[model samples]
Target chain A: MKARVIVSFKDEVLDPQGLTIKNALHSLGYKFIKDVRQGKVFDIEIDGISVEDARKYLQEIADKVLANPVIEKFHWEIIEK
Target chain B: MKARVIVSFKDEVLDPQGLTIKNALHSLGYKFIKDVRQGKVFDIEIDGISVEDARKYLQEIADKVLANPVIEKFHWEIIEK
Candidate 1:
């Protein structure tokens, strides 16, 4: 099974990286660009686990390590590969 | 219009960050995790453009700025609000 985790900064956490990207886009003549929020995507392949267990375990990992709970949030889904 | 860009390392590019996460997951007891590939997701909010143009312009930004074409590839999609 393949599991995907998406992690992003909390809304109140200012994202300098996103701001920099937005500025870069503006300079590149993509004047239509308004705002940008950047996030992380982790694509994982695993074995010896049921789909349910895969989701459960990945969720734990997401919380404990994949994301920083104080300033970031994460979501995960199982992908059929 | 809103657009999203997903940027990822090329197949030949080594992803040290992904490996770090994999190891972290292993240490966290997510022993089931096998292979991991990490990527970037940019969620953008924009105005004054049709969806088609939004996609086109974001694609250009992705190519020239959002991604390092020498070692990364990207895909973008327009999302309805």
Candidate 2:
């Protein structure tokens, strides 16, 4: 199975990188752009794992490694091969 | 209409954030984790625009604002309401 993990900063966390991109977009004449929030995506291929196991494992990964719980949040979906 | 934009660093660019997460995962006992690359996803709601027009406008936004062409790549999909 494959999985796609998305990790992003929480709403109250300051996102300087996202802000920089937003400003760059405004300068590039995309006035329609309203907001920009930057996040991370992890595409992974996990072999021989059941969907339930995958979810549990991924959650652990997210909590312990992929995201900082205080400032970030992560969610993932198992992809069908 | 809604759009989902996925922006990522090109393979050649160094992703320190991704590396840090990968290392953290290793430390956290996720030995199964092999590689981790991070990217951004933009969920946008675009009002009053045709799909083609939206694509064109988003392309300009991505090129000029959302992504750094020198180091990043961006792709977006229009979502039907």
Query: Candidate 1, after superposition: displacement of residue A45 in Å?
Result: 0.9
> What does candidate 2 score on TM?
0.74
- Model 2 DockQ reads 0.43
Task: Give chain B TM-scores in order.
Answer: 0.89, 0.91
Q: Model 1, A6-66: lDDT tens per residue?
A: 8999989999999998998888777777889999988888999887777778878889887
CA lDDT for candidate 2: 0.75
Over 4 Å off, model 2: B10-27, B43-51, B68-71, B79-81
- Candidate with top DockQ is 1
Q: Write the per-residue lDDT of candidate 1 for residues B26-69, one digit (tens) a residue.
A: 88777778889999989888999877676677777889888999
lDDT of 2 at B60: 77
Model 1 spans > 4 angstroms off: none
Candidate 1, DockQ score (0 to 1):
0.85
